[model samples]
Target: MRFLQNLLSFKQPSVMRRIDIALIVAVIPHLPYLSGFILAFLFVSVIVIIYIKKVSKSLVNTFMVIGLLLIFISFYGELNYAGISRFSVFISLISAMLIYVVMLQRLSGRVNFYLLFSPALLLILSFFFYNTIPMLLYMIFAIFTFSTMLLWSVMEVNLGIVLKKSLSLFLLSLPIVLILFLLFPRVSFERASYGFTNDQMMRTSHDGTMSIGSDALLVPSQRIVMEILFDKKIPPASKLYFRGSTLYSKKAGVWKQIPQKMLHFKALQKRGEKTSYKVTLYPTFKKYIYTLDYSQRALEASKITDDHILLADKNTEKVKHYKATSYLDYINAEKLSAIKRESALDFNATDYPQLYTLAKALQDTSTNKSLLNLITYFKQSQLIYSLKPEIDENSPEESFLFKYKKGYCVHYASTFTLLSRALGIPSRVVTGYKSNREYVYKNYLIVRESDAHAWVELYLDGAWKRYDPTAYATSSDLLPKENQFLNDLSINYLYLKHIIENWVLEYTRDKQLNILKKLLEDSMFAFTFTFYVLSFIAIVLLAGLYFRRDKQVHPTQKIIDKLLKKLNKRGYKKDKDEDINTFLTAIDLAQIQEINTLYHKIRYARSSSTDEVKKLNKLIKGISSKNPKYP
Candidate 1:
């Protein structure tokens, strides 16, 4: 029974027990992918058990220690799996837990209510020292947690006067902080301090081939990969194309990018008008940047290779904004060089014998240009269009052509390019996102990964003309309006994520210095310094105000004053301006005798005394501590 009573004692609640409960809740969402939901249910069951068992103090303490060990173990496991050390996370958790335990144990019932909430105060300070969170988010979370703790302490400790005064001080400090944040001169260093590499790009889509016996296709990833921004009148959603790599070679049933080679644009000058736009591309974990055809000029610091595609020398870790100028009316008719043509048309005759025979039969029926005939046949065929394609166990290409006949842009473009090459037409596969969703604030079209597509570009009439074999294969409603809405939401999300990456994650010394230089040049540095000084002064003033208010007579002191007044009304009046001891001696004989012994005991005590003076203290103690007559 004594052990049970200790477990239920509010003054001595086990710190480890609280930590155990918190750890169990925090780790439930991070279980193995397959077991996550099951583990969550099991954690909930544990919570129920803890509640029902009414665990003893010793058991609670034991569980808390076990929980701390498990938390450390989990942190190490995360470090191992992530291939990065989480020493800071481990240290912060341990420090926070230790500080919490110490504060709870040593400070209970001794300090003012705010002082008893030292654990929360230390946690806020930890966030600042750790630098594990964004400054803005850290400040917000700190304020929120601190405010919540303050409110809870006020309710639990009945510190209404302190709460009111603290709240007033907080309200007075907000405007000053806001003013400082806005006016501060931001500085950057010459060298960039932070950057993201291509390794961070979250790859969500697979290449042409699919692995057997794996659940690769159904692996759901919610990561937003890229955001595109375009200037000027928004292009029709159908005409928006984010052009990427041109794959002209296939070996072992896998599409490979052809080596970069120049293609002459004979009718480049024919375009009376040109459209120049900027693309703020997110890192796609691939080198290629999608742009329209016949690109004549690229922005500074970007490389325009022979294929008229733009490539950035630096890996695009965040949203990379670049300008591309493309001709709207240029014709690409430089026929493929003999070597290139042969390579483009090259395919293993023995591997796909049936496909080759079918292509030859179709070739014999065409009287016009082989490329034109192929294009016409594909546009006029009964091949269905669908995102879901049936994979054949025996032969994928054969099944796609003869039986299933329905697939995405990849299937259509792959089949078309291969068959065109068989019919003596040099064709290449181009992969990129098609269509853009416009954002209101950016005033630019945003593209997404779901818009990833494949099409064919054939060498024709002295230039390469784009031919989307899947264009005709897809109906207008193939992508539902709802899908487009979701795509829009995804693009917006990516844009916000890009902003966070650029402004927070990739914020570096160079950027900071640049900002400082700009501020100095604009004569804003003086204003910033003044603002900061003024704000600091204001905070100091507000803090002083709060301290002064807190230093006033405590509630216990008020009760002592009331007791003195009551004694005076009962004819044991203190002399006007008399000292406390003199006032006690002046009381009537009966009253003096009643309170003198108690007053001596309280006044000359070696340790700290309660607010109650000796006379009232003895009476209250007798009634409350012994007889309980006050109740």
Candidate 2:
């Protein structure tokens, strides 16, 4: 019981305990799958534990809990659609939080030992538990989180001392790191692409075949997946149709891509003035990339496939930044061949009976121009644009024509393509992201998956012309005009993600080498080397200063000083302030018995004399060695 009491009363406060709590708070944002309620309960319990143990008080705890809860709740809508992986993430977060708390309590108040080693321990344990997760990602999170904890611990222990030192070091290293990043020799090594592959597989738009049900629901995703930057000024919005795959054939209510072997790219007769632009694409895992009608020249990373469509070298997993130069006029001027024309017009009339009848009726009444006019007529009439359109049991196209006249970009684009094919006009569905009007940041345009769109490209008078029936159907929904607050927040978040992707994930060996080379060339090398040497010297100096501050005289020396002062006050004079060995020879054993004994021990003891020597030696020698008659 007494030991327990002492342990509880241990004067040193546990800095690790506080730090663990703080880390938990910081990590909650990343655990999207975890139920907010469960996390809320756990967080509250931790805060209560801290308060009960006198680590923190009620008010601060309440505010923290409330604030974190609000943040978690705000992301609930997104979480619902994010799928099961998010839930697994929450479980891992809970495990991490529990481990942090247990470890902190065990360490007590020894903050430095805990601060430096806890992360390493956590990283080891994380692997045992989260073996399924990628080690690289885990390492990244561990390094970042632990580094933050270390910084916090350093500040707490040494107050502002560590910060000042670190800042000085950072300033010295900054220029060197920058130079190395810039001037490093770059090699074009193949990089593994990253993005939502499952999202791509599930993506109906990428396949070019669109159903009213699936396509309608994807309209409001609003998550920007890629960004485009032009070397020159961005092209006009009307000319901006980032092309994916061209769906040349529709059979049995499905859109079909032209076989790669059958399709071929023809060189332009006279290449027009080429405009170069770079597209930083978010991975859809789909082969096709949207380019303006024809590309005269492409970067080494990209290839011109059939239909003048651009295909990346490999599937992308993340944001892929690649450059391409296109001759916009040459592509616009190319005539559609018979094979292309036949494929675009080849729709199975047997499968879509009503669509076939509609086409026949239009053809019977009017010419090719009238059939084109009919598309505008249908879009203008009663069709409404929406994210969630009413899905029916019958054929989706027939449903769109008869039932819910309302639909999204997919509905309009799909209907328009089918109608054009039925009217003997060569047309196909083009799928890719649409333009985002809001300028997100410098040299980047935010294109969200919700910006995923489908439009018809009709081969008109020997040239394929872009036609957006959905744009005509829903002009009001083109760009978000209202709800400026949400819009701004979303755009800002996307922009931050863009920067992280570009700066960190895309940071190559070339970039690192360049930074190092630049540092060498810049004379910053001298400054850096000098700074490191000075820093080492300063650390040693500070350590020496602290050591001196903590220094104390030995107990034996203190005792001797006190005895000498006492003897002087009593008028017992010693010749020259003699050393212990010389002074002991003259000191009378009978007088000042304890002092005489201490002096003998100091002069004769095998080991250096201390408080133990004074105490034990006086007991042994005072009675026997001192003559009591003189005292």
Candidate 3:
């Protein structure tokens, strides 16, 4: 009976326990985003105060106030937009205050209840910022640790028992949480006056006009521009040219796209060998879809220009999906009008006399092989391909061709177009993604942002033929060879990333509906899902029951626990960090000293005889009898 009363009694949390709770509740969320200065400051402060003194309640309160002030100042102008930050700040402040309050004052029922449950709020907030798999693993550990601490804070219990109960509670709640998440109605109609509500939702910047002759080097954007889900066959890297826009007007060395009205779109007759695909495009804040070469739009409200480049009907600030079909290993046989031919062949001839002299000589040397001669010249001309290309802004074309000679796909494309036009061959620059390499998952091909490329297209044999001079540039030792191991690691990382994004993060309402439809179609899958869910629930309940069974305790441990409880009721509460000897010494109690000596033998020296257990229990009973209120 005395043991039962001791087991159910409340106790003050130790200094270490209070600090642990405060640190977790106040600091963990900000860990990922904390500055180096703040971390160093904290480290220095900890070292300075290590053995000087115990943690002061005043110090904790001061820090809490400072944190609150910083939060307010940081979010001064953006309070409306900083709702999440505000929530985190408030929780941290309350947790810190409660922890310090516990240290200085007696644990009132209200205060104890709030302290017990406040950390749970931090756990919920954790999900808002970090819902990734790694964070999920961390959360499991955190939930167990904090919940165990909470259990210990409120009641006098064995450490192992506290751990077991915490685990049981967490597991028991998991099934119900999952059930609620699945069955919860997320979509709702806002209002009705015959008016129902509708549901709604930079990953990359692809909207900027792809200017031709700018001396500024192209920065490689690894930010994903879009993802492609090929309906059928995935195109090879050599052939995957995602045509965006065609630049026809060239003046002052810079090439610009002709106005929308100036370009013409002819119907594509070669649909027999078409490859159908869907594009899940990231927001570029522009309408450009960056569709495949010779692409024809298959979805409504999608636009395809004469250049075979697809676009959304409106600017998209969010992810938008569209379907299109593109022909592979086929020429765009649409004959260019005389005006279009002139536009394609147009360039500033007066500006490039040196280039024209070279072009005319090549044209004269090989009349029938002008295009091939020009391509061979580019291949033979030791021009380096790089992200950071050096070209004089005043003479970008001349400097790129004759002087610097090092450039990216843009340089290769622009120079090749100028040379082709100089030779009177109809040519223009096409800027889009060259999504050659891709991760193939579940019959879908994934293309990322690094594939953004520019190339030239020349009119040959009554059809526009794609000429990738950048491929020629790569054939030369311009760029350093990629480390095979690093490349493979990167590919694997991307593959895993796309898997997570598609199956986890991007699993939308539509995907859920499709999954349900499939489950309905297959009775076996539905049955399997239902059976697993029910089994999970049953297993959770059984596990909880198993863990809830009476935990076996050593007789010596029981005696020590009873003694601690009796002392607590008599206003000689032992510090949680205090060992049996230290606590007894602090109390200066002769009776506790005898129990402490016996406990040490059983706990440390392996002396657990029945006589020792009875003796320790006898000492505990004497203490309890003297302090009857404790009993």
Candidate 4:
């Protein structure tokens, strides 16, 4: 019990209280992504102050001013902007000023008020940076700690009691806070648009570019760019080609795509096996919106390009939720025009002579025959699937196909597209993500950036069909083992992350309305929601009643009354009009005088010292012994 009491103790020295306030303020401005330098500075500064055993108020004030100037200069770049960065810097500056006020000033009514208000301000500022459940709990704790400190500065009371009162007050205020938050107005926008702030904050792992020969080594990434919640079961790994864009032009082994006019091509609607799904895409700062094989219609606030790629009107700087319907065996049955066919088949013969020679040898009279021959030719080769493939920069195509015969999906896709174009079979390189490791957690599918993939789309038999030559190679050997403990742990982490995102970060006004609409659609849900709201109100009312119950008598008053009863029993009946001094004079005893002094200090001066109470108890016993009739 003693150890537990000590563990819950809240007593601290004067300088330690100031340091605690400073440290709490220091932590608030850097949430979600705090800088290491600032954290180290706060710790080191507090430690040095404690070890020195003395604090010169003037010296502390001077250093505070210097710190403010240095902070301003350090964030001068952010100050020039009109975004979240600038807002964060402004918040930090305000926090610094408040911390100085709390730490440097001596204990007084004014200082107590400042100390109480600083942590609340910091808590409010924290909402701008993060709004997770953990942050909400931390905010409540900040309030409780500062409130306890405020009470301690003014009243000498047990630490446990102080903590109890502060915690009760915080709990009682929560319902009101929640109500206000729900009814507050929020900014609304229909489309996902990324700004400079988003770029500065969250960077995409792999840039959405389909160029080739840029880097010899391909680094594997595990970042999650998007997650899908399908209306039905997920498709097979072989058919999971999230089409982002198509690269049709090639120059010196580097494939690139020209910007096509938005909404130029009429989407040909052909009924087939289709899967409807909703995507929760993170901020990519790019225009492309990845989808499956073919999408018949564009997502809301987005458009379909001439290359049949879905694109947002602007960059996706926010978490975007959009629905898309994709056909499993989608065949773009629209016959390519003569001009389109020539453009798709056009490639620089001089740039890829070795590929051209191979294409010439493998060409057949028919388009299907030529495509089959090329795919067969690749399968017959000894090329292996590798994460990082070594190729000669000057002759990448020749090195990859003839010498090394080991490259990644990009090499295979680029090589197949070039060879098909050379053999008069129009083809384009498709770059997007492929999900082999699809985790089914509560019906939603989670896919990571390690699934980023590349393939070829050949225009055969008046329809575009997908081909993946890399699938012919041993691609599984290049990736990590499945069903391992780490994989299971990863799935668990993703499940938790999904809950946080859906419940807190992406809970926008539209989503709230959607939730309400769904709740109202079902009788049980409506009843449950209404019941919850009413229960919350009832709880608040009950809490108010608990606080409003009649106050008990003060402990000091009870102790004084017991002493008076003992005196009355001893035949020294106190006059009703006599105060403590008059009663003590009538008694005329040294022990009674001492008891009277202690009683007056406690009852009149509002002191509650345990030592004084003990002395009064001893003095009362002495009086009782002097008069044998005392109770």
What digit string (tens of lDDT, one per residue) describes model 2 on residues 254-328?
Answer: 566876432244676444576676666655666666655456554456676556667767755444567666665
TM-scores, in order shown?
A: 0.54, 0.55, 0.63, 0.72
Evaluation by lDDT, superior candidate among 2 and 4 = 4
Lowest lDDT sum, 10 consecutive residues, model 1, at 208-217
Best by lDDT: 4
lDDT of 1 at 590: 56
| Clash totals for all candidate models | 15, 17, 0, 1
Candidate 3 lDDT over 19-110, as tens digits, reads 44654554476445433434443444445345435546565556445544554554455456565356544443343333334322221212
Candidates ranked by TM-score? 4, 3, 2, 1
Model 3 residue runs over 4 Å out of place are 1-27, 30-116, 122-184, 188-214, 218-234, 261-267, 270-287, 298-302, 312-341, 361-369, 376-405, 436-450, 460-463, 474-483, 522-631
Worst 10 residues of 4 by lDDT: 191-200
Better of 1 and 2 by lDDT: 2
Overlapping backbone residue pairs in candidate 2 total 17
Native RMSD of candidate 4 (Å) = 8.4
Judged by whole-model lDDT over C-alpha atoms, candidate 4 comes out at 0.68
Deviation in Å, model 1, residue 383 alpha carbon: 1.8
| Candidate 3 worst ten-residue window by lDDT | 191-200
